[model samples]
Target: MRFATYLHDGVTHAGVVGDDGLHALPDGATVLGLVRNGLPTALAQGTRALRSPAVPIERVRLLPPLDPPTVRDFVAFEEHVEGVVASVGDGAGVVPEWYEAPTFYFTNPYALVGAHDDVPVPPGSRLFDFELEVAAVIGHDGTSLTPAEARDAIFGYTILNDWSARDLQRREMKVDLGPAKGKDSATTLGPWLVTADELEPFRDGDGFLAPAMRVSVNGREIGHDLLSNMGWPFEDLVSYASRGTWVRAGDVLGSGTCGNGGCLAELWGRGRPVPALAPGDVVEMTVEGLGTIRNTVVAGVDLPPVAPARPRPRKRAR
Candidate 1:
């Protein structure tokens, strides 16, 4: 079943998407609460509630499908890594260590925005870019889960765009440590959260999940890749992320960026930096079996600058 968190009549709601429309969950409850309450039990209760006549998908504004307590985005796609490394002249081929272990970073849960929302270009930012990715939502809570078990712990998957500010990133990475400020501003997620059971057919072909993914800007297809191309799969990433940390329901794990030059930074050398997105520029990202998330870029309103303090008179020397 596909699930979503949406705003209707100024209130946020959790519901399951159906052929007719959305079937709303109970009042004051959220997708996170359902997951934390255990997938089986939650599904049982939610499934029943979805049959109500009052709930309809057309009347709501879709938000991120789940409200994660924490979000960990992993660089599990070697194509993206290699492309980035090549862009920075950091050598070719996958870094061997990346395969042996999963590498990830944290994103603020509060920064998440729903599909179709306007993504504001931060003031003073001239180098904004978009990354196409797939993220997993955790269901079972555990620490140090094995790869096999980790697969079962996943609740579902959703699309994510790790919007980046190249200028800010470059300055910070010079310290050789973080991708923080550059990435923290915003992370776009959702259209719907698809359940694990719904994805079983796609996984059946090769006993692994390999969805076709693509992205476009202003109706021009720019990048595409298959989930099969990932160097480290979701299960491996889950195992690594859970090694010493507890992963609970509503926690998110992203599959980093995909290949085929999803962002302009990879397609064109960052020599001049990609043009800043302006109001009315539509960006669309899609994954097979899942849906498309379309966002329009809007120029943010500039805040008034603070006035400079007046200079004080020099004190007399004694």
Candidate 2:
């Protein structure tokens, strides 16, 4: 079943998506609450709730399915790494340690937007890009879980667009630290959430889902790839992320950018020279079975700068 959080008559609600329309869950049930209770319980509750009348799906404005407690995005696609590495120049390539484990970074959870919202060009950014990927929402809390256990912890899947400011990311990482302010502006998750059972038909053996993933600018298709192309599967990404830490309900784990031109940087790295996103440009990403999310780029306002920290006098240890 697909679950959604939406606005109707100036009020926010959580509902189950169905052929008739959007079935509102009782007692102000939220998508986060549903996932927190795990699928079996949520499904049972949702089934009973469907007896109520549904609102027309098109009439309500959709919101991100849930406000994640944390968003952990992993670089699990080798082809994407290879292309982006080449783009960053000095002829750098994927590192050896990258092959040893799934690596991820925490992105701001508060910076999330809905599927159809407008995203602003981050302040002081010119090289804007969109990453095409998939994400799994954690169904329950767990730490140090096995791959199988981690897989079971997933509530559902959704399309993830990791919006980026390439210029800010490059400058900040020079100190070997961040994608911070660069990436903190916005991340998109939605259309809605599809239950794990809904995607089982696309499973590739004991590996990743082989859903067809695509992204476009305005109306032009820029990239396409299969979800099965990831260097490490979702279970590994989740298990690795949970090592020595808890991943609770409403926490999100992204499958990272896909290969074969998932982002403009990878295309630029391959010498395509596609222009960065500009005001009014529309970006739409679609994953087979997961649905599409569209966001229009808008101009950002300039803010006064904060003073940088003054360098302190250094004293050598005696």
Candidate 3:
């Protein structure tokens, strides 16, 4: 079943998406609450409330399906890594350690925007890009879980658009340290979350879902691929992320950027010089089974310039 967090008549609500409309959960009960209580089972039990008249989906404003706990985005696509490695002309091949385990970076959770929200390009951002990927929301508590256990912990899936500022990212990555200021600028999730039970048929015996994914800019298709292209499965990523660490409900794990030109960097690697996002450009992404999320680029906060640095004092010691 599908679920969403939304605002209607100036009030925020959480509910299950049905053909008729959205069946509301009790006041203040969020999808995050459903994850903490255990998905499907707890959600089914909670449906008994069905807060008064179901609101038509179109009448309400959608928010990120879950109030994100923490976000960890993993680089699981070799195709994507190769494109980026080539773009920089660093002569760095995919590292040996990368092949040995799932590699990832933590991103800020506070900058999240929901479907259709306009993201302001941060000041001085020159190379704006969108990453098309899928994310699994953790529903249970576990530490150092087995792959099978990790697979079971997945509550649902949603599309993740890890909006990136290439210029800022390049500056930090050169130090071999961070994607922080670059990545933390913004991250988009939604259109809503679909429970795992709804996607069981798509997961083959190998435990991978071969969902068709794509992204579009201003109504023009830019990239497409199958989720099966990932070098690693979501379960492998979860097991790796939970190594000797606690993964609580509400944590999000992304499939990283899918290569088939899902990101502008990949297009550039192939000699397509697409311009960065200008004000008012709309970007949309969709993953099979998981719904589509569309966001618009908006004007940024233009703050006053910084003061000039003072000259250093002359040496005085003798």
**Who wins the TM-score comparison?**
2
The global C-alpha lDDT for each of the candidates, from Candidate 1 onward, is: 0.80, 0.90, 0.85
Per-residue alpha-carbon lDDT of model 2 for 1-318, expressed as tens digits?
899999999999999888899899986688998998889998998897788899997798889999889999999999998887776533488988889999899999999899999999999898999999999999999999999999898889999999999888887777776578888899999999999889989988856789999999999999999999998778888899989989999899999999888999899888898999999999999999999999999999787775788997786875
Residue 135 of model 1, lDDT score? 91
Model 3 clash number: 0
lDDT of 1 at 216: 88
Tell me the deviation in Å of residue 8 in model 3.
1.0
For 1-318, candidate 3 gives per-residue lDDT tens digits of 788888889998888887678878888788898888887565674466454567888888888888877999998988888777666436475778879999999998898888878998876787888999999999998999999999999998988999988887887789888687778878898888888877777776767888899899999999898888888899899999999998889999999999878898877776788887878999999888887899999888786654567897787985
Model 3: lowest-lDDT 10 consecutive positions: 43-52
Worst 10 residues of 1 by lDDT: 268-277
Which model is ahead, 1 or 3, in terms of lDDT? Answer: 3
**In model 2, which residue pairs have backbone atoms overlapping below 3 Å?**
none
Off by over 4 Å in 1: 54-58, 88-94, 204-206, 269-276, 301-318
**Which scores higher on TM-score, 1 or 2?**
2
